[model samples]
Target: MPVAYNDDMDKRLIQLGAAVIDTEAHAIAALRTRINGNFAAACKYMLACEGRIVILGMGKSGHIGGKIAATLASTGTPAFFVHPGEASHGDLGMITEKDVVLALSNSGETEEICTILPLIKRLGVPLIALTGQPRSTLGKVADIHIDISVEKEACPLGLAPTASSTATLAMGDALAIALLESRGFTAEDFARSHPGGRLGRRLLLRISDIMHKGEEIPAIPENVLLSSALLEMTRKGLGMTAVVNAQNHAVGIFTDGDLRRALDQGIDVHITPIAKIMTANCKTLGPDLLAAEALQIMQRHRINALLVVDTEQRLIGALNMHDLLRAGVL
Candidate 1:
């Protein structure tokens, strides 16, 4: 059974939720000042690292460290997370002289991480630390220390890792993005790392991959009648047909929109040449163009279809908005 609603209690809960967001927001906002020379040095170390960046943390900081590692890996930086506890039991071998170690601890003295500091130092790898306490064991030992302290936690009890964790994650993102820019990483580079994701499809899929080709393309000769063009459009079901010249060059395009305008003008579909109703010099795309870019062209011109042409402007394929939708490029 549902309990009766308490209006005053509900109001108080809503206000508490808003206050928590405000607290976390302020914590992240304060991190802007922490992006200093030390931040630059940390990025430098990671950028120069030949092996994967090994991240270590305990409890909540460990969760944040995992996310930070993932962000770095996807942004053209090689990185992975190793639990501090696991490092004690032979996992410490994973950290090599070519790698850089990044440790996260709000108190700057997580026992699990401290246990491996000597091993990491012995490996002679660069160590960067994210901690609220600059004078703590982890911070004092690190070659580079980044302060991620916050004024207060969003937790009312001041015990949970709320604001501090948020600050650490933001700093991690700052490091990843700074290195990404430093490496001159482009969208194509990012797509290579994320071939299974939506962004990869948008970047890697070309018009040739999805456009209707050969017999699938609805194209008619410029001298064909409007009635024949309509039949071709129906057979192809692409809602459009390209009007080609004697050399199979796309001279114009006839789409559903053109059919509407021709009807509004009371033109004879059976007797009128397709050229009379076709849009001359219609927008055409190269087969090598990206499908995502094709969508942009369609949107900017307010058209639903496009003809694919070769370097000589000869019609090679055709595609419509539906093709993009079906291909997941929309």
Candidate 2:
């Protein structure tokens, strides 16, 4: 009997969770239509603003506002969150004519947000509002109105922020991504804002930043015996040596695997010139190529090392899998 009772309770809890998700999904679908020219105008104003975007809200809206500000700032638009309550004191000084204000309120009559409107207006900063009520105080006074209204809250009591907060967050994401695309923001631009993160490492790392150059490059002349090539590969420990011609241009490559194959073919390492056993036209990379691309090439070729060459095919650098790992490009 106890098990049966607990099972029924679990079922009820699951149903409630599903209801909340469905309600929020519906709310966002409805909000999609509100993304017309008005939304574009707001993005335009933000793009042209020489100063930063100042976001404001209270309670759950405040939390969402902070996330929106972060997304906008990270994606190329500079932005920050100023709690409406704090702004009424001295935080309002953060706003200027060069800036833009984005205020969020479900009812659009939150006293904290409305109380500061006059000051922002006095500063001549453009105002954009995300509110459930277009006729409410915030929407009525804003230069742009983004309707974040919802049919109903997902809360069984229809009081908690659930569905409305989801809609507001979705709207915020819509605005940020649209602005990101309009500004032609690339992964590299986004990486600059997140230099300490993994995406930044992947997007900003180049082969030149990690490759071994100068004396670190392992190479042997085509006339060198296979034993000399093996010694060069051992000294560099990259498991390979570039075979360069009289002009010092890479003509072939000899790796540990190549040596093994040569030995199996009954060739004497002491007597054979490296040119006799080297793989000609081996895959080479340029200095400016992304380290991420280098990783791909190495993986596809099942090789552990690569020779970096110029357009004329002179060996300028060398790198192994370990170098990429140390540089965090792995």
Candidate 3:
């Protein structure tokens, strides 16, 4: 075809893509009206369960069920996915009396899912169903049924699972997050569940986890010459040094910025004491604070480093942006 014709076809495809997104979005929004006491009852049942949430599904619903299970596990509620087909084999042994079974079937009549209904019932487990047909076999058999019905699929043929899948996923997120809040799941709790992730590192890491302590801490006496402070800064490579008094409490800090200012004033580095040119009463934080919190302090003060101190104001450690970056807290 001609170049112009190809360009026009591309624009039409883009318009169709946008329309599909809009249709899916509207389908999810429509679920807000369907959120009744049934939703609350489902949450209560899951919360009261003593064992893990065993989610079962087939095909696309199976894919979404796995994701929902993962979300529930990472948040507060414990959950895991089980293939309905696999349950027919020996995998059904994984189910226990304490577990709550969550089965997903939009039509509520998948033969595989319905076949295992009797087995699930025999275990004396509570069954929560996410289905379009609440009056169907699976829904009718479930202890609690959540309606995920949608007007239509986004596909033009109305044969593919689009809007219904979106609605199911949104409902799953709603249930998981609502249960998470009710359980008082905190950021620290989430961090523990995801210790390998960046958010986990940020929330769980303390300033002491990344700060330089002991002999590695850069320091100098308040009476030291400006040249001696510069030598200490270079040796420590922290670009600054805490100036301590006889009691070892920090009185001030001399940084590279201070050195530039001192040079601008034409001061003699050999004769002038660091206390004369240092920035006194600098902002300091305790080692117990989170490294993420310390990053915020550095951002608010527009500085590159902060000294860690005790309640008595004695310098115990030091760190800069480089430390935070290396620790993956930045």
Q: Candidate 1: minimum summed lDDT over ten consecutive residues — where? A: 2-11
lDDT for each residue of candidate 3 in 1-330, tens digit (9 for 90 to 100): 654535877999888999999999998998898788988989988999999999999999999999999999999899999999999998899999999999999999988899899999999999999999999999999999999988889999998999999999999999999999999999999999999999999999999888999998999998889999999999999999999999989888988888888999999989998888899999899989999999999999899989999999999999999999999988
Model 3, position 283, has a per-residue lDDT of 86
Give the winner by lDDT.
1
Instruction: Say which prediction, candidate 1 or candidate 3, comes out ahead on TM-score.
Output: 3
RMSD of each: 2.8, 3.4, 2.7
Rank order (by lDDT, best first): 1, 3, 2
Task: List TM-scores for all candidates, in order.
Answer: 0.93, 0.90, 0.96
Q: Which prediction has more favorable lDDT, 1 or 3?
A: 1
1-330: candidate 1 lDDT, tens digit per residue: 966556998879888999999999999999998899999999999989999899999999999999999999999999999999999998998888999999999999899999989989999999999999999999999999999999999999999999999999999999999999999999999999988888999999999999999999998999989999999999999999999999999999999999999999999998999988799989998999999999999999999999999999989999999999988888
Q: List the candidates ranked by TM-score, beginning with the highest.
A: 3, 1, 2
Query: Model 2, 248: alpha-carbon shift in Å?
Result: 2.6
Q: How accurate is candidate 2 locally (lDDT)?
A: 0.92
lDDT of 2 by residue, 105-168 (tens): 9999999999999998999999999999999999999999999999999998999999999999
